[model samples]
Structures are given as C-alpha cells and as structure tokens.
Target: MDMVISNLQQQRAVTEQLRREAAIKRMLVSQAVADIVKFINEHEQDDCLLHGFTSQRINPFREKSSCTLI
Candidate 1:
C-alpha cells in the first residue's frame, strides 16, 4: 500500500513539471510572434521610405515628362 502511494506521488510530480514547461514554452512563442510582427512592420516602412514613398504631403501619382523640343 505504501509503495503504491509513493508511485502515485511521483507520477503527479512529473505531470506538474510537464505542465509548467508547456506553459513557459507557450509564453515564449507568444513573445517571439510579437517580435516578428514588429520587425516586419518596421521593415516595410523602411522599404517604402527607401523607394521614395513618403507621406510628406506630396503627390503620389504624378507623371513626369521626359521629352524636350529644341
């Protein structure tokens, strides 16, 4: 009877440890996803700036003339 009780207690401890580890892993994954989304947003804004797509109150759909007459 004592041996059976001891075995049950050990199993419960192991189960609790596994549950804690799973919770930590879930938190880490959530943090990593947030970081990745922030990085992508920043990268997109930088790309737009690099390509002259600014929001400084300028025309964004204007056409340029490339012909000259002498």
Candidate 2:
C-alpha cells in the first residue's frame, strides 16, 4: 500500500538522521578522548594524575575511606 511505503520511507529517514547524530557524538567523544590522551602524555611525569582521581579519592589506594560514616 502507498501509505505503508510512505511510513517505511519516513522511518528510514528518521533512522538515517539518528545515525548521523550518533556518528557526530562518536566523533566528539573520540576528539575528547584524544585530547585527554595528549594531556596525560604531556603530564605523565608529574604528580598531576595522582591527585586527579575521583573527587576526594586523591590517594585512591589508601585503606581508609576519606569520609567516615557515623
């Protein structure tokens, strides 16, 4: 049916648009990761990375949790 065909075409168009948006997001993430890699490489010899762990987990491997529960 003509209506069925039109619906299929519309779905395909929507899918293609979503694919394009996902591809763009992938590109942005790739670029961000590349920038982070470059930054880490540039700072590999410094103490910068160690202190850059999770917000307050500066010494990530330490036995005591930074926040003590009451």
Candidate 3:
C-alpha cells in the first residue's frame, strides 16, 4: 500500500538522521577525550594524578602510593 510505503520511508529517514547525529556526537566525544589526554600528558609530573577522565596536580592522599590504592 502507498501509506505503508510512505510510513516506511519516514521511518528510514528518521533512522538515518539518528545515525548521523550519533556519529557526530561520537566524534565530538572522541575529540574531547583526545584533548584531555594530551593536556594531561603534557602537564604530567611526579605529583600529578589522573583520576578517571580528569587530572589533578595534588595527590589525594598523604602517601603517594595511597593514590593508587584504587
């Protein structure tokens, strides 16, 4: 039927749009992660600690080894 065909076309369009948007978002997140890693690596030092996706200059514990207690 014509109506069924049209509905399928609309659904396909929506699916394609969602895929494009997801790809764009994925690229943006990848770029952000790369930037964060570059920054951390550049500024990394004896006292620097990377916690998850972020970096901190000061150790969170009294002993440096305690930071790796995770």
Candidate 4:
C-alpha cells in the first residue's frame, strides 16, 4: 500500500511538469505570430510610399508630352 501511494505521487508530479511546459510553449508561439504580423504591416506601408514616389516621378514626363499637343 505504501509503494502504491509513492508511485501515484510521482505520476502527479510528472503530469504537472508537462502541463507547465505546454503552457510556456503556447505563449512563445503566440508572441512569434504577433511579431510576424507587425513586421508585415510595417513592410506594406513602406511599399506604398515607394510606389507613390515612383508614380509621381513619372507623371511629369507624361504631362509634358501631352501638353505639347494641346
């Protein structure tokens, strides 16, 4: 009877350790996902700025040719 009680206590300790490890792993994964989303949002804003600048630079050339015909 004493041996059985000791075995049960050991099993409970192991199960608690596994649960704590799983919780830590879940938190780490959630943080990584948040960081990735933040990076993508920043990159998209940078891309929009670059596109706008390029379009503005090309517009003057287009306007000059069109105005000569007017």
lDDT (0 to 1) per candidate? 0.79, 0.79, 0.71, 0.76
- What does candidate 1's lDDT look like per residue over 1-70, in tens digits? 9999999999999999999988873458789999999998889756655677555446455575589889
Error of 1 at 41 (Å): 23
lDDT of 1 at 66: 83
Better of 3 and 4 by lDDT: 4
* Backbone Cα, N, C clashes tallied per candidate: 0, 0, 0, 0
lDDT tens digits, residue span 1-62, model 2: 99999999999999999999888734587899999999988887675555555555666656
Ranking by lDDT: 2, 1, 4, 3
Q: Which segments of model 1 are wrong by more than 4 Å?
A: 26-70
Task: Give per-residue CA lDDT, model 3, range 1-70, as digits (tens).
Answer: 9999999999999999999988873458789999999987877763234433233434354445435454
Error of 2 at 21 (Å): 0.1
List where candidate 2 sits over 4 angstroms from the true fold.
26-70
